[model samples]
Target: MRELITKYKPVIKFIVLFLGAYLLLSVAYGGYLKVSSHYGYTPDFITDLVANQSSWLINAAGYKAQVIPHDAKPQMKLIVDGNYLANIIEGCNAMSIIVLFIAFVIAFAQKLKKTVLFILGGSLLIYIVNIVRIAILAIALYKYPEHQSILHSVVFPGIIYGMVFLLWMLWIKMIKKSAT
Candidate 1:
């Protein structure tokens, strides 16, 4: 057992750091969720906010968009030009992705200033991309409702995750440079 541990020490260290940081951040997020829930900030609040924000972007892009609130479900309707194109849910808000991004960045454990700045910048990028993704998806669904599954499941998710992958790569390069 000791020999095996010594042989894979670096891998073990990485796993420990990543899991520890992820768990800590996730627990803090859970606490935040609880506090928000206690204060009446339901999942619908986040969904509605993202839907309205996405609606603004869609409208600004020359389409008439509006958000329809739901009482029973934590979802909002994204209406574009009198057509219901998509339902905005809590998952659509990009908070979980931001949390994942922060956890990864924290795991990498850059300098204090660099880590904080990267998290802030990366979170903003993810949020903006999410809004744009929602807007573009709304437009695409309006034009070609036939390809709904591919667009929603493949293309949109690819864009967001692809961006995060790129960010992670860039962070790795930064870490390498700082280390050397």
Candidate 2:
């Protein structure tokens, strides 16, 4: 057992660091949400952006869309043509991307000089993709309200995860090239 552990020490360290960082980020994010809710400091930027985009989506679909705040929670509920379609909660959609990035950073800790830029760029891309995802989801809900469940639960998650996978692949390619 000791011999085996010594042989794969690097791999074990990578896994431990990745898991620790990911867990810490998740906990911090959850705490942020809780405190933000309690103090009513949730950023107005997303809410306003969604509201404006909802109007456009509603007009395009010829259906009335309403985005209203939940009374008991710090979340936005999207109502489409008088029916509840989806709820936009803080840290709900981008949790995977955030966690995955933290994991990736930890996994690349030794190569920080080469990887930090990649990490930052990837994070920015993820953020932009998230906004696009939300917008596309809004449009999707407007176009095919009946398919909201699949789109919201499955398709969107796949998109974000797919993007994260692509980012990781890109990182690997870059690291390989650097080694060569």
Candidate 3:
């Protein structure tokens, strides 16, 4: 048992770090949600920010885009060109994705300064990409309502997750190069 543990120490360490970070961040987020709801921030600040940015981008693309609070839920209703397109929910905010990204990056962390910088930069990149993704998705939905299922379920998810995967790979390569 000791030999096996010694042999796989790095793997074990990675797993523990990843799970610990993920759980801690997720709990913090849940607390934020609870507090926001308690204080009357219906959609929460991050989700609202994402919705507003997405709407701004869609408007910049020549569409009359706007976001309004949902009447029955904690979400924003995205309207483009007077068409009811999609709902911007808390999940759409991408904080969860950022949390996942941060967890993975921390698992493979190199140095304190580099790790913190990467987390900050990577989180910002993910947030911006999510806003753009939401904008493009809204525009695509407005243009091709028929393909809504595929666009929402598969394609857009692939884009964001794919971007995170690429970032992870880049981080690994960067650390390896620095170590050498």
> Each model's TM-score, in the order given?
0.90, 0.78, 0.99
Global CA lDDT of candidate 1, please? 0.86
- Tens digit of lDDT per residue, candidate 2, span 1-180? 999999999889989888888888888776765665566643333444545464455656566777777777666777776767667775554655766885776686647666667767787788667767776787787679889789988998899889888888877777678779
Better candidate number, 1 or 3, judged by TM-score: 3
The TM-score of candidate 2 is 0.78
Models ranked on lDDT:
3, 1, 2
Residues 1-180 of candidate 3 have per-residue lDDT tens digits of 999999999999999999999999999999999999887766998899899999999999999999999998999999999999999999999999999999999999988999999999999999999999999999999999999999999999999999999999999999999989
**Every candidate's lDDT:** 0.86, 0.71, 0.96
State, as a TM-score between 0 and 1, how close model 1 is to the true structure.
0.90
* Tens digit of per-residue lDDT, candidate 1, span 53-162: 89999999999999876566657878899998878887898888888888788778768999999999999999999999999999999999999999999999999999
> What C-alpha RMSD separates each model from the true structure?
1.8, 3.5, 0.6
Worst 10 residues of 2 by lDDT: 41-50
